[model samples]
Target: MATANADAAEVERLYELGDRLSSAKDKSQHAADYEAIIASVKGQNVKAKQLAAQLIPRYFRSFPALGTFAMEAMFDLVEMEELAIRIQAIRGFPLLGKDAEFISKIADILGQLLTSGTAFLLSFLSSNVKCGYASQVLSCISEENVERDAVHKALMSLIRQDVKNSLQPLFKHVESGSEIREKIICFLRDKVFPVKAELLKPQAEMERYITDLIKKSVQDVTGLEFKLFMDFLRSLSIFGDTAPRESFQELIEIIQAQADLDAQFDVSDIDHIERWTSCIYMALPIFTVWPIQLNNN
Candidate 1:
């Protein structure tokens, strides 16, 4: 077909542009070249679109200049049949690892990707493909230890702006049976890795901010969310006696609510009994308190 030849020519042109951007020695000049490529791809004739698709990924990891430009161009590429390009975009997050500003910029792109209505972008985020890198990004965000307000805002931004409906995957990480909760606590405490001195240092403003969040969790309706919120509190070593007291009260409330709900149900039913048995067994040691022996008065 004559159309096939046009597609092939378009592909070659995209590849040439990628090569130019990748090898360009001057930073500003290279950026300009990639911008030209962006314009070329955007204005590509129908047959050229197919060619552009094939070059997207190849140019993605080419160089910082090209990589940054490609990332910026992703919003335009989503509608094209450039699955490889989108995949590269997700995978390339690691390249932005060391620079907070660049990482934030890419995070903005990720926010856009989530709402692009493209299944490929969603799958890239929610799928196992990006989990390891995603974890790395999370680790960086936590380590930066900017103020608590800033950290909370960044985390909330990633969840609310980027994850959207894709949040189920992250929520699953904090589920009742998931190991991430324990992992988080262990990492922040002296168990897995010793808490760094810097992390232990106080920021009055940040603590006050976190204290407010702790207080708000008490009014949260979702039991799982409340539990996860508590777990998050336990991970942050800065929480003091006041926060713990509030947390204890919240915990008792949750336990009492569970007791009341269980009492209203017929525990004799096989399925109910099974569920109750698991809950009680799990709660027994976890909820139990042992009386300390003392000298007789």
Candidate 2:
């Protein structure tokens, strides 16, 4: 094994070597240099790890293939006992995107972290750290013109199979009535637009789930939670076409009841008029179709 030097010259030499190796089209030469550089940096100090991280995005942009191999190797370093090394690895996941197996690799890494007994992985997902990776994956898959249905199905599969109970942890941030609510609302709103009808239409039990979700959202509101409620209402109204007239009537009653109760309680903060307007509009399309059928009969 070639010894790693403690001197700054050795660190710069390795960083520069990695940069050059990134462009080498000869696969064997590239791998040899990449491995040497990774090994050198592992033995070097924290500064070397930071330099390696800074190089990763560029590596990804240039030698995307080599970057994939490097990123996998970095995972071990991130899981290392050294904090600096781990930070470097965290910064390196973006490079993994170039790999065909990136999504599965990321999902597996996140799954392990999420299911681990310790809170480190959960905490990682909380704020800027982990969510970015998820967002990146979403954007990459969506932008690459990967099959929309496949991506949607994959997410639904995870929700249904792996993370059914785990969703509540992610929802806590959404439920906290903070800025994260906006992100959650945007995500769910997008869901409503593209795939909501398809996802909800096949299940006979969808009406019940929809009703329960909307009612729970309304009931869960203690303060001015009207914005998210409106978003949900818009989605429900847009996608609730397959629901029965009874479902529509039940929704109308829920809105009217809420409005009446709010008035009696002097809930000035509540936007009763908007809720009423939404319900009225939501009912119009259904009612119009029904009347046509009735007249034809």
Candidate 3:
């Protein structure tokens, strides 16, 4: 019972400290208070940790000098066992790295998160963060001043390195009504696909890559999966002038097969038929016109 009382007292104390930091007039005193809160985070106090997670971003925004320390703390929080703490850490990202000067640093940190902290970070962002917010963070990293090409290359390399395994979590989120669907599609369309189209050659190796990506996106028959597959096709169409004729033909065949399967369903399944038909209709024009477009180009 005494332990429970102590925990309650600690939570209240943390909240009081948060209030004090918010209203503190002296800049030095505010920094000192923020540092104290950061220290309290190390103790076995859940409330302190939560409050610290919430305040770090604010402190980083208010005091640029504290950003390096705040970011270090945020990265540590990313690995925390508690979901709430991790979520708050992810939330702090936008504020912590909002300045133009911090974009490259943010990109490097994000690359690390992608490489080493893939599962939980991706899961949390996909399920928890709002749709456009993810795109915003990505856009910051891809800004002109930052190493856009390098970051894009690293991201595509990660994707191509394990197209199936790396994207499975993202695909699962799309299937489960997560906002990550829009974020992933936007990132691919805006950052990766455009650059990749220029670099990709009409070679056997490139064909295999395209084939693998399409096959992975089409592996499931869920409605959301179908939508994601269509989005992939749409992204490819943006490179119509550069895309190989044979690759487009293969994609057409895959869509046709899906359409045929949809036709096999009973008339009562009008919704399924309509969905499949729409995808086929949307994709057909791009696939059919690509060869002509390439010739014109």
Candidate 4:
């Protein structure tokens, strides 16, 4: 029941598809072809999924109405257990760049994959590792997760527009858990924290933006997010401290805002205990570099 064209080499197959679409009496009538391609992406075959990844972006122009459907299909591809499949799909992200609305979705995918997603389960970030060496460290530490570099490059490219769209998605994963929290932090530590100022706006502007986000959204953050936000502050203080002396004071204010030093909770409540435990555990890094502004000053 298979057509000779279906099993052709990639280049040949794509050529035939282009001719078919270009020469067709009515392109809309190819809905079945479109559906078949979408179904192939979500199918069980690894190679087929890989092929579909390329096809999704290629056919996107002819089917602008299916951009949502195209993105959904790509989402399914990113989650595949196969590394090649994931990278193949990720490479397609920038192709979708023409559509700004997909930025948030792309951010969510990047954050999840870098965090606890099955595709790229990562080791905890090597702490106190000096700057100028993140790339080597990431490679050595996360060998099986080679996709780290791909995802990082994709993230950096995707953030060029709608930069704030990446914030909520990336921050949502920074919660209290083993692999989830630590690995995502590692991504920020290695990929995000140490970027040269030229990559985006100046570090000072970036710092101010996050500062304002925290000021406006601190109450909305969970215990885990608060803990993560503190870690983010610590990183910014270390690598991009144009606001150094002032940030130390601001850090004190943020801590005070989140703490109820005199308030007590049920001793048996495990969630409360864990949150406090994480708070204390996380603070060790903060205390280690207490008065961070001093070095920068």
| TM-score against truth, every candidate | 0.41, 0.38, 0.42, 0.60
C-alpha RMSD in Å of predicted model 4 compared with the true structure: 9.8
Candidate 3 per-residue lDDT, tens place, 1-297, comes to: 997788788778767777887787765557777776677667776666877888877766666777677777877776677656755665565565555455445444444443333344456567646755777455433432233333345445444444433334444433444444444544555665555544345434553565455565454455555665655554654334566677566666666655555346776888767866766675667656674222211
RMSD of 3: 13.8
Could you tell me how far off, in angstroms, the CA of residue 106 lies in candidate 2 after the best superposition? 1.6
TM-score of 1: 0.41
Per-residue lDDT tens digits for candidate 2, residues 106-205, read: 4344333322212333444465454458875544344323222323333344433323122333344344554444434444445443555555553445
Q: Which residue pairs in candidate 1 collide? A: none
Candidate 2 residue-wise lDDT at 190: 56
Candidate 3: the clashing residue pairs are none
> Which ranges of candidate 4 are over 4 A from the true structure?
1-6, 9-12, 18-36, 42-45, 59-62, 115-143, 175-179, 199-205, 213-249, 258-260, 264-297
Identify the runs in model 3 with alpha carbons over 4 angstroms from their true place. 25-28, 111-297
Kindly give the stretch of ten consecutive residues in candidate 3 with the minimal lDDT sum. 142-151
Tens digits of lDDT, candidate 1, 241-283:
4344444444444434433443557746665455445434433
83 in model 2: Cα distance from truth in Å?
A: 4.7
Best candidate, TM-score: 4
Q: Which of candidates 1 and 3 is the stronger one according to TM-score?
A: 3
